[model samples]
Every structure is written in structure tokens, then in C-alpha cells.
Target: MKCLSMLAAALAVAGSVQAAEVQVAVAANFTAPMRKIAPMFEADTGHKAVLSFGSTGKFYTQIVNGAPFGVLLAADDATPARLEREGLGGSRFTYAVGRLVLWSRQAELVDAHGAVLKAGKFERLAVADPKLAPYGAAAYETLTKLGLLDTLRPKLVQGENIGQAYQFAATGNAQLGFVALSQVQADGKLKEGSAWIVPLSMHTPIRQDAILLAKAKDNKAAAAFMQYLRIDKVRAVMRAYGYEH
Candidate 1:
């Protein structure tokens, strides 16, 4: 029965080669890129990444309270650092530097220099809630730097997060909005309408970071996905979405 024994051993080896699924919590600003990359990761490694998107701040709260996420891709570096300090995460690194942009679905609405802020041409200008979204904080900083915060306060409509802020602008609920450049860019160019890329000097850098949660420290699938993020092909996908490594 040597052949039967060998067949049993081969089946055991095949079972050992099968990959596991990992759960990930992603920042709202990164949803698009992650959506594109997750399947690629699964195809390459035989591992599955189940992703959930939302504000990093909310994710932080959930993680602290024992959410089952194995990894976190935050919109800003601070949240990931905090998780590490709190002993909830390990092996953190800056994955991308995010850029903020002033976008309008309508053509000729937002000028290249973003001077429309001073002209008061729009009835409602949307921004993500500064308390929840890092991009929202950057938007607030940009407005303050441009001396428009006080003047534009009355005209502001705040979204729950950057994704929602983008929706407000896209659906014409708000005339224009401050959103992540990735939301408006595709294939290394603006997909539609008018946009003013905010100068990085106007606000603090949005250094997005990723971390392996302590809960998944020993998880092979979680570790594989984290390594996949650093691969050149994945970085290229991130670049197409306007992220800088």
C-alpha cells in the first residue's frame, strides 16, 4: 500500500499549501486602490483579502475595542503610530503620501490655481469632517492657509468622510469639494471635469501608513498581503491612483 500512503502524503502537502483569508480595514481615501489591488494579491499569493473601508479614526476606535481586522491602511501616519503605541499593531510603515485636491464635476468651475475659493462663486463647498478624516483636516488647513476659512465657513457643507465629500461634489449636492487626488485621478490624469491640485506646501503632508495588527502578527495570509503591498506592480497601481510612495 506504498502508493496509497504516498497519495495520502501528497494530499496533506496540498492542503498545507492552501492559503488563508485575512480581514483588512482601509481608510476611505484608499478604497479605490485597495479594491484594485486585493484581487491581484489573491491571484498572486492564493490568499484572500477581505476589506472594509471607513474613516481611520473610526477604525482606530474599532481596533482598540477588538475588531477582527488583521491589517490597517490608514489615511494618515498618526493613527497607525497611535495603534503601535497602544500595543494594537506591529511593523508599521508609510505606504503612500496622499494629495488633496479641489474638484468640481462641472467644467471651468475650479481654476488651476484654486483661486475660486476667494471668488465665492459657489453656494456650497464641501469638506470632510475635520475631526474624522485626515484629508478633511488637510482641507481645513488649506483653507486656513489661503485665508478663506472664516469667509467660507457659512458656505461649507461637511461630509462624514472623504468618500462622502467626493459624493457630495459628484452628485451636485455641493458645488465643489476638497477630496483626495486619488478620487479624481485615473491612469495618471484627471478623469473628468476641473480640479486644482493643492500644493503640498499649503498643508501638512498626508503621509498614509499601513500596519499589521497585533491580532494577525502570526497570520501567514496577513503577512503575505502586507508584503504584496511593497511589490512593484502593486506600487504601480497605487501610483495610477495618485499615491506617492
Candidate 2:
């Protein structure tokens, strides 16, 4: 594949620069793209990104509780902004804009218009904990905008993070879920099942932000990783996973 070839080529470009690792706290919804980017990042920059993924809120709590994360890739802009305001972070920037989707592992369970929600055909619907994951909040906002929140509240199942919400649908624990589009799509196409790409108008934009944590202010690898996010190849990888700038 062209992408694999690119990654291999990038990895072959060994540098004379010293190598170091940076601990990164990443948002759960960004798991797929971040996994691909990490290897490419090491190959290109001679630095390894040690990644840990979870809900933005939980990661924030961990960061506040003395977690040694050098950088944070958050699911929402607010978390990074809050860190920067509190002097816990620096060099904050918007890395990606996430899209929400109503998805199901079954080929036709989810309709293009997402009418199935109002039809009440499914017994369960999964969403990440809105208090933790921005995608979950967007899901709730979508339901409220559609006037279906109260009607569907009884059937809602909550996950600690977007990854778990996606798992609930993938494993059939729920008939459907509100999840990040990146989880079910790749190379500009759906990897499996069916989904309704939730309209942006239904909720506020999910502006995923990245920041350099104060703890790693002097860490070269952390600084390099933040700068590396602006490269074309890196942006290209993000696009393949359904993220928008």
C-alpha cells in the first residue's frame, strides 16, 4: 500500500540526532490515527512518543494529579485551553476537528438519515460518558436538537470513553452507538458496517487540541513531536482517518 510504503521509507531515514521519549496523553477518539502517526513520528524525528489514551476529562484529572505526561492531545479544545490557562501547558494548538457518527456494526442497521433513533427499533444505544468525552456530549446535544433525548434516555448505555462506546457497538452489547467517525472509517471510506455522519449543525465543533505540558517544557522530544504535527505527511495520515483540520 502507498501509505505503508511511505511509512517504511520514513523509518529508513535514520538521523544522527540523539533519540528520546516523550510521554503523551492522547484522547480516546484519536486512537486510530495517533497509532499510525506515532511510528511515523519516530522514524522522521528520531524521537519516540509514549502514548496513553483515555477520555479528555480523565486525562485532565490525571494531569492535575501529577501525571508526568509531557504533552496532551485532547478530544476537545477546552481541556487544553484550561491547562494553558492554569500554567500546566504551553504551545496549545488545534490539531484536528472531529466528526460524530451514529454507527452500527450491522451492515444496514444505521440509516443515512439516522431515522432509526426516532423509529425506536433498537433496544440499546451506547454513548461515551458526556461528562468525560466530548464526543459523548455531542451525542447528547444531537439527541436534544432532534427532540429525542427524553425519549431515548432510558435506552442509553454509557462508556467511560469513546473507545469503549465504540466497543459496545462493535461487540453487539448495544445495537448502535454515537462514536467518532475516525473509529469506523479509513482511507476516506467506511471500514465496516454503516453509519450516519452526524451533521455539524447538530452540535458544537469537536475541536481536538494539542499542548505541550509544563512538566516537559525542556524535553526535546516533546517539542519535536508538537512541531511534527504540522508536517504535510502527518496531516495526510490524519486525513486518512477522517479528521479535518
Candidate 3:
């Protein structure tokens, strides 16, 4: 009992001494899971995660322009690799594998087989800008695989990122939109809308990667946060939001 007490005291002192804040730029698709994770991370490690969520492409640009981000959780693996090659990033690894979905506000608007897309019943079909979001690229690839890109091109509406695309569908600005599965799913079920979870064969895998930025090389909090992401608790949260880790 006395040895256990001494070990507990030592751990408490170490945590207090190492506690610090990490600035993380997270992809928009990871918002829900990250929100839940940030608090848990702080509680567990005595380090605070200051998160900013947005499109991975935009965040990459920002990082290049000297954005004060200590870490990046990108929506695609390529961005981190680019940063690594440019010497702007340190350690990197795949944190999650994302899934795409065609979602609608109406519960029955999207069929399980995703045949509604061919029905042409909707006037507007929203998608993120493929140049700025990986999910958008996946959506386009899916459309192409189904031989529907040219047919649906006329009705396409673009958003700056997946979050905006989801908003467009959620607010009825677009009848339906291509979004991250994590955005509309929790507890292994859809939240409020109808969706067709796009098959993996339709596009390249969306391997989301996390990187320790060059500016954060000496930041212990940043390194700890990156390591924390691999814990079982964090993986559970990612799974709950439909992310494969």
C-alpha cells in the first residue's frame, strides 16, 4: 500500500510538471470525435488540446504559410507525406481511414442501394470542392465509377469543405450531399438523415494521417497528444463516429 501511494504521488508530480497546451489543426470530418476526445485527453494526460477544425487542404496551405499549428490531423495521407518531404513535418502515421456517404435530410430520400442518385429527382446535388477536400475527390471518383459524373455534372453544387457540404444538405440548400460517414453516424447508426455508405471499391482509400509539425518538434505536449491518439479509448471514440482506425 505504501509503495502504491508513492508511485501515485510520483505520477501526479510528473503530470503536473509536463502539462501544457497543444495546438492541433484537425480535419472537419473529425470534428465530432475530436470534440469528445479533447476533454478526455486533457483529463488523462494533464495536457490541453486546442483544436481548430477545417478542410485538410486549406490547413496544409495555412501550415505552409506559418500557421501556428503544432500538429495536423489531415483528411488524407498525401498531405502529411507532402509536408514530410518538404521538411515541414516530423513523425506521421495514419490515424483513421475515412468513409464517404451520400446523405439527405429526408429519411427516405437516399436509398440503401444509392439508386436515388440516378433517379434525377433532385435539383441540386452538393459536394465539397475536390481541389480542397479529399471527400470531394472521393465523391467525384464514386460518380465516375458509376458512370454518373457527366450526367450529374449539371446539378452539382460545391462547398469549400465537407462541413459546408454537410451543412448545405442539412439545411436543405441542397437536396443531397456527399459527406463523411463520421458526420452523420454515431453509435453504429445514422443520426437523423438517410444515407448510402459508399462502397470502398468506388474510390481510393481515404487514409487520414496525423503529423507532428516541424514547429512542434520540441513541444512535449504535442508529442504526447499524438501518442495519445493511439490509445484504445481514442480508438473507441473514432469507431463510434464511423471511422476505421
Tell me the TM-score of each prediction against the true structure.
0.93, 0.94, 0.94
lDDT of 3 by residue, 1-245 (tens): 45544543443355578798889999999999999999977777688889999999999999999999999999999999999999999789999999999999998999998999999899999999999899999999999999999999999999999999999999999999999999999988899979999999999999999999999998878987887787766788999889996
Write the number of the candidate with greater lDDT, choosing between 1 and 3: 3
Report the lDDT tens digits of candidate 2 across residue range 1-245.
47655543544353225778899999999999999999988877688999999999999999999999999999999999999999999899999999999999999988999999999999899999999999999999999999999999999999999999999999999999999999999999999999999999999999999999999998978987887787777888889888999
Give the worst 10-residue stretch by lDDT in candidate 2: 7-16
TM-score result, candidate 1? 0.93
Candidate 1 colliding pairs: none
Off by over 4 Å in 3: 1-14
Give the range where candidate 1 is weakest over 10 consecutive residues by summed lDDT: 7-16
Candidate 3 least-lDDT 10 residues: 3-12
Question: Residue 106 deviation, candidate 3, in Å?
Answer: 0.2
Per-model C-alpha RMSD: 7.0, 3.7, 3.8
Kindly indicate the candidate among 1 and 2 with the higher TM-score.
2
Model 2 bad stretches (over 4 Å): 1-15
